[model samples]
Target: MSTQPPRLPPPAPEDAAARNMRLLVLLRWLAVGGQLATILIVHYGLDIRLPIAPMIVVLAALVMLNVMTWLGHPHWPVTNFQLFGTLACDVVALSVQLYLSGGASNPFVSLYLLQVVMGAVLLHAWSSWALVGLTSLALGLVAWLSPPLALPPWFATTLSPVYVIGLWCNFVLAAVLLVLFVTRIAANLRSRDAHLAAMRQRAAEEDHIVRMGLLASGAAHELGTPLSSISVLLGDWKGEAAIRADPRLAAEVDEMQAEVMRCKTIVSGILFAAGEVTGEAPERTTLRRFLGGIVAAWPGQVTFEDRLGEDRGIVADRALAQALTNLFDNAAEAGASAILLTAKLEETMLVLTVADDGSGFPAAVLAALGRPYNTSKDRRGAGLGLFLATNVLRTLGGTVQARNRPEGGAETILRLPLVSLALEGSR
Candidate 1:
């Protein structure tokens, strides 16, 4: 099996409070602009006698506060308390404007509901209710204390249709703006949550891979000395006169030697995976030559077909070879007598297909092809062959897929982008 150092997932991103605060600041600017326009329309167009000087002072104070807020640590996370205080400031500003113009009789007096709705959507339940109470109290006090705004004679009448129409327009405008901002904000929150969840999953996967690597490395270290001793004894016996006299004894000794070498290779692979030792470095070779070399290493019968026409050079990585070897080993375990490997260029990608005339993977295994420990085999080994292959290929900007062949077998497809491989080599 290819021994790759465990892959660690990237770090989780910082919280979204800073971003949300920036967004709120922009929204507040919109609110300021809207209020300024409304004030101008009432003072000039309607020709009303109102305290423009005091009203302008209130607007200027709000604008200054917003400016300070913008400059103050834009990177600082906005907490619920901070948001609550900001909304409270807005409510106070609106109440002051209403008190000067027309108390609770102003059509824009309904704008208090905007702060209430925002509080409900953005703050904790208790905090939102607190804001509602505060705004309600402010509204009542304004109506009881401030003098009424001077308006056209037609609107002064209690039964005036113009007053009713103005209220209707305020209600519609408030409803539309509230729904629009709330929906957009809600979507932003959902997107942030989803991204965080995905990062958490990757972290879990990385942890599992790290634990597995530790176990493999420890086992390899413990077994290496004994396997080496066995090989030495086998070599000595093979060179003896008594063993040479008997063909059966010589054959058995040779088989033992081969098995010992296999064990050594396995231990080395594990050590390499632990990043404790470096194996053979990557070799520069054509795609056809690389595939041929790997297939040649297998003792079983394998049919190889290369249809790429011209030779395409690649850096041969030991891990890639080990990954493919693991796949072949799985195919052999599934009772495949002969395997077929075909390679071709699909656009700018190298597509290699490995097919075996064995019982195809069960439905369950096919569904979770590259997940670790998902296998039907009863063996000492974990079902990590496909998992390792998948990860290794993924690191090279490639993908591995498995399927059951209708012709009574299993097939694996590996697609690797040539450009990605070249880029990886350059790096």
Candidate 2:
């Protein structure tokens, strides 16, 4: 039998574009606020005779554009072309405002650089350069066509104290915005990279599990013949007249047969886990009965509690049963005198918890839980129980959590969607 991990799909470009579009919308709102404050200060505070009506019209148009973009954002995927168009609109709006104020002579004309920087960060090469060309053209048109601003005699020239102070303010605003927006964009990129890295790690772990399963399946196949031969020999000895006459001999033969049968059952489980057809159909049973069987079969001092109100029908999943057994084995190895198992249904999920009155997990083992070979045992190939259990639950769209109780001992919790094991047509 062979198996492979499910491949993870790469993130779509539209995802990043959509996120950047949101940033642009936020920046646009900031632009509106800044533009309004600047317009009011220049026209009223500075006593500058400016084209207030037309500039206000431009501001209103920007506000309406932002509103439309916000409303349509969820309905459509944002694309590179759309982002380019948004930047272009801002460029035109800024050009008109600059033209109304003082054309290229306006101190805030440097704001064009902010848009160019944003484009380079958020756009593709072609779009970034296109924005550059568009901004350059707008700058030239404003310089050539805009009417001169009627400034006070003291502030008439570009070298006036008030004009130099305006340039200083423009520099400050540009610097602040660049820092804010660029840092946020970088954070978005970093988050995407981290998510991709995690996906890669999970793929690698699943591949390792596949290889291990193949090896185990091959070993089980090789052991099957010898185990069957031994079983036949044990049966023959049990039937012998001498052994039947001797109670001690008969008891010994019976014990050997039982052990051999247990070994065969374990091999069958291995084959089943490898995705091989076991020549037997899965047993259909209710959740309550399934849990009861596992508890009754466990050869240990254990308690079982089922708080799952109404019973639901499900297929008997041998792999899941084996995973639970692995947890029980671990508890036994930890010197647990008694183990407690609890089951409950939380909406569509089945929640199971196993707790042991043994020494809690070591800090290092707890920290690296679910990782192969991460165990406190000094024996070779130890610590695979929890690793395999974790992977099995994960394959069924479930998760396992391990923690030490404050009072004492350790607890492991398993949660899986009941739909994964639900019988067909059984709610």
**The 10-residue segment with the lowest total lDDT in model 1:** 157-166
lDDT of 2: 0.87
What's the distance in Å from true for residue 68, model 1? 50
Per-residue lDDT of 41-130 in model 1, one digit per residue for the tens?
878888877798898898898889788878984556678788888889988998899899887578787888878787767776567668
TM of each candidate vs. truth: 0.58, 0.64
Encode model 2's per-residue lDDT on 1-427: one tens digit a residue: 8899999998655577888988899999999999999999989999988888999999999999999998998789888899999999999999999989987578788888888788878876677768777876776677668778889997785545465456545544554465457656766888999999989989988999999999999999999999999999999998899999999999999989888998898899899889898797878999999988888777777799889999989998888898998899999999999899999999999999999989989999989989999999999989998898899999999999999989889999999999999998874
Runs with alpha carbons beyond 4 Å of true place in candidate 1: 1-181, 278-282, 378-380, 419-427
Which segments of model 2 are wrong by more than 4 Å?
A: 1-158
Per the 3 Å backbone cut-off, how many clashing residue pairs does candidate 2 have? 0
Model 2 lowest lDDT segment of ten: 167-176
